[model samples]
Target: MDWDKLRIFHAVADAGSLTHAGDTLNLSQSAVSRQIRGLEESLNATLFHRHARGLILTEQGELLFDATRSMAQRLDAAEARIRDSKEEVFGELRVTTTTGFGSLWLAPRLNKLYEKFPDLRIDLMLEERVLDLPMREADVAIRLKEPSQADLIRKRLMGVNMRLYASKDYLDARGRPEKIEDLSHHRLICQNVNSTQVSAGSTYTQELLTYNIPSLLTVNNYFGVLQATLNGLGIGVLPDYILADFPDIERVLPPSESREIPVFLAYPEELRHSKRIAAFRDFVTEEIFEHRKNLHESGDT
Candidate 1:
């Protein structure tokens, strides 16, 4: 019931060690232990199971921790809102997206963003896992699919297809496969079936494997597949979004592509008024517009 005690308990539960929690809270270990004991006494609950390794949450502690975590997120949202009142996009903005898109697409274009907001500190988290925007795990997300999370402002950024591509050097050296069946003679570079990718990409890879390609180079992410293909390794199944930055790679078997994968940019609805979020969202939207225009001028269908 005490907000200060709840805060201390959350820190201790998170760190799983009184000493570590003490260090974070700027309190002595004894002080932190006393707070935890007081909190437990007030609720008549055993919050943690002490062990040689660290404190493990008891059943009651788990429930309390969940409540504390929610409170922490709400407080984080409030803190972010307060920071945004300065009307400056000059603070930490945590962005999340897939490694392929982040590295090949968004990361390269970030220089323009930096040029505009020189003081902005962007923590770009690149992974396949979808971060919780509403919970403040990330400030913004560019995902391969729509985020189903509630209380989020979602925008469709772009569409991508899991299409086959090969480096010009690779195609020249090995002879490009003209048809899907011709893939049997070439090495295949793709994401492993076990990898965390959109369903469309995995489904496309699965369909390609049916060709019974003799040689294979499967990586956990598209970035690896891109590098391998760049080195003249094999035909790689990659997203079409890479084409804007990497036109040197030639599309192979253009008709053999996967269903469209929708790319979405999302943030918490609560972040609607944040200047950092506004700037970032506008930057991304402008980049998408430019990309589409270039694709059109280049006669891309």
Candidate 2:
């Protein structure tokens, strides 16, 4: 159980080549190979299968690699905690959220955050998958629902609903649907009913389909739906929050909308004291507050 040898083994397993691992670790190829050999000898395990193409991890190597990956994430978390300054917020903060909210909402407002903490480096991971925050897959998450994961500090950010919208041109050309039943004459753009999304959205889409809409465009994510709607393709089912930034898109069938989807901001309890987390949390909270204020002022709420 030599830490140095294990480190070298992890690198080699990761790169699948002695020379590549050596370049990364600043060791000669022979040195790297020697370390791997010694590690295998000490453990009495064949860690990798060597071939002309490259090295592939054996069963033992796969187990060790999984352990090392966890170790690396834990080490990264520790390093971030140690680097946090009392008064300064810098270094990397990894944030994960749904692609729609990240790209359509948070990403656009990040310039204000940079203006205040220019030294801060943010890695925005946008996808539908919920990353393991406690294991440091990401430092923070803004989820569409309250996170079911334990040992995390969660805050309800806001509530969102899937509502109908269309570009002004589309409405002017095709006309707006005054009632839900009138949707039968219009093209409906929305997230696919089978896509991985909040139940509320899929349910809303299902209800819309009951009207026997003749034309439909279904995307997996709201961004795609937003894009098609913006281009005047059809009336799109989208999150109401999008209205704060995309005010030009007119809301259609105002009485028809989805159930509330609660937005939550969550982080590991361990990160509760991290200054970077505090700064990011505050920035997002403030942004949402401002967004709500604007919506109310414009009577869109």
Candidate 3:
């Protein structure tokens, strides 16, 4: 019930050691231990099971920890709202997206954003796992599919398709396939069919594999696939959005491609008024527009 005690308990539970929690809270280990004891006495519950290794949460501890975690997230959200100045776009903005898109596309274009808001701090999280926006796990997300979470604002950023590509040197060495059936003679590089990815990409890879290709190199992510293709290893199944930045790579069997995968940018409804969120949203939207423009001018379609 006491805010300070709850805070201390959360820290101790998180660190799993009184000494470590003391270090974080700027208190002596004895003081932290005293607070924990007091909290347990107040609630008549054993919060942690002491052991040689460290402290493990008891059943009651787990429940209290969950509540404390929720409180911490809400406090963080409130602090973020307070720090978001109406006229200035500065402070940390956490963005999450797939490794392929984040590395190949968004990361490269971030320089322009920095030039505009030199004081802005961005934490870019690249992975296949979808972070929870409403819980403040991340401030914004660019996902391969629509977010089903409630009380969030979503926007469709763009559409992408999985297509075959290889570096000029690789295509020249192995020869390019004129049709889908000709893939039988070439080594195929792609994401592992079982790896976590958009259904469109996985289904496309499966279809390509059905060609009975003799040689194959599978990586769990597209960055690896791109690297292998760049090194003249094999033709790779990759997203079409990569063409804007990597013009040197040639599309193989242009007629063959995957179904369209929708790309969406989303943030919690609570972040609607945050200037940091607004700046980031506009920056990404503008970059996508420019990306589309570049692709059109180059006749890459």
Best by the TM-score measure: 3
TM-scores of the candidates are 0.94, 0.97, 0.98
Candidate 3 C-alpha lDDT tens digits along 1-301: 8889999999999999999999999999999999999999999999999999999999999999999999999999999999984589998999999999999999999999999999999999999999999999999999999999999999999999999999998888778788898999999999998999999999999999999899999999999999998888889999989987886798899878999999999999998999998889999999999988988898866
Which parts of model 1 are misplaced by more than 4 Å?
Answer: none
* Deviation from native of the Cα of residue 176 in model 2, angstroms: 1.4
- In candidate 1 the C-alpha lDDT for residue 60 amounts to 99
Local error of candidate 3 at residue 119 (angstroms): 1.5
RMSD to the true structure for each prediction, in A, is 1.7, 1.1, 0.9
- Per-residue lDDT of candidate 2, residues 17-75 (tens digit): 99999999999999999999999999999999999999999999999999998888889
Model 1 pairs whose backbones collide = none
Which model, 1 or 2, shows the larger lDDT?
Answer: 2
Please tell me which model should have the higher lDDT, number 1 or number 3: 3
Stretches off by above 4 angstroms in model 3 are none
Distance from true location, Cα of 59 in model 3, Å: 0.2
Ranked by lDDT from best down, the candidates are 3, 2, 1
Give the worst 10-residue stretch by lDDT in candidate 3: 82-91
